[model samples]
Target: MMLFAVEWQPPRLDTGDLARIAARLRGLRPLESILDDIGDVIGDQDPPAAEAPVLAERLRGDLVRLEDVAVAADDRDPRVAHLVARARALRRREAPTAAHPVTVAHLRRLVGAAEALLERLTETGTLRACA
Candidate 1:
């Protein structure tokens, strides 16, 4: 009988990769804040004219940051791509009016999508602090 010894090494992440992951984790805070603002606007009977555009712009910027991190990490998560696409679509729309229920619904979905993406990233160890 022959005995064989096998060596196992843990996966390695470079400093740049860790920095990107940390940045992504930090970016989640602003995304959550934007989602909260969107929810507040949705709760209102009449959302202010200027507020929606500002929120939408903020959301777009946050999504762009997330997308850049995802791309740098070579993340293949479908939800991340979908979330980016949705944010881009929302960004392209004219300022949403209180009368447009569909737009409100889309905003709600976008918030949900952002939350989902954040959860997935956290779960995948991609949002962990650099150690």
Candidate 2:
């Protein structure tokens, strides 16, 4: 039996909100963080029976997906070697199902690498402003 002390519902995300959310993801922070914030907003509306576990799952998925992006970037652009390595490291850290000191450190590395790559692409005229 599902016994809930409080009724809950996630936030409503309009199409326009999603578009702006996507743009923020391209910023300095990791996408996992953005997912967490979104989840919190969802929880605020629906008040999840519990929030921590669900948020953790969302974050984990985001990291995994980011790792995939790193790998694909690796295959397409050998220049992204550092980012690729950091991504693989992050995947390994997250695969264990528990956080460690190294995990945080590695996450920072991945974010830095991703930011560097973004900067390089922008500087080289590969990615246009606001595009």
Candidate 3:
């Protein structure tokens, strides 16, 4: 009888996704800073009338950046769709137009949503240790 050899191969994990996720996580710092800025604006009891427009423009710029990142991530992985939707919703929100008390509450919600999304993103990892 002739002996035959069989080879076993390990399953492959998506390392590219991990690398992209890592990059995206690093990209979150600027968004976090903008969120802090929003919080500060919300806390200001007597923000000058002129300040509202500047704050709105700044927040809009950062939220647009966030939307771009979220959309790209969602395109890569549909699992990120929910978080992406939240980013879109916040971008379209009227709260940032002015920092009224209602806007303050909305800004707080926005911050919470962003933190949750980041926390969820951090939970993503490759199935294999080497992956």
Say which candidate scores most in lDDT: 1
lDDT of 1 by residue, 97-129 (tens): 666565556556555655555566666656643
Off by over 4 Å in 1: 1-49, 97-103, 128-131
The sequence of per-residue lDDT tens digits that candidate 2 reaches over residues 2-113 is 9885868788999999989988777545543543444453443532334434543444455455546555544455555555565455445542234543333444444454
Going through the candidates in the order shown, the clash numbers are: 0, 2, 0
> Looking at model 2, how many pairs of residues clash?
2
Q: Judged by lDDT relative to the true structure, which candidate is superior, 1 or 3?
A: 1
By descending TM-score, how would the candidates be arranged?
Answer: 1, 3, 2
lDDT of all the models against the reference? 0.61, 0.49, 0.57
lDDT tens string, model 3, 9-127?
A: 76665999779989988866544565465565656563455555565556655556555655555444455567667766776776554446555555556655555555445454311
In TM-score terms, candidate 2 sits at: 0.32
Between candidates 1 and 2, the TM-score winner? 1
Look at candidate 1 and give me any clashing residue pairs.
none
Residues forming the 10-long window of minimal summed lDDT in candidate 1: 122-131
Global CA lDDT of candidate 3, please?
0.57
TM-score on alpha carbons, each prediction: 0.52, 0.32, 0.46
lDDT of 1 at 32: 50
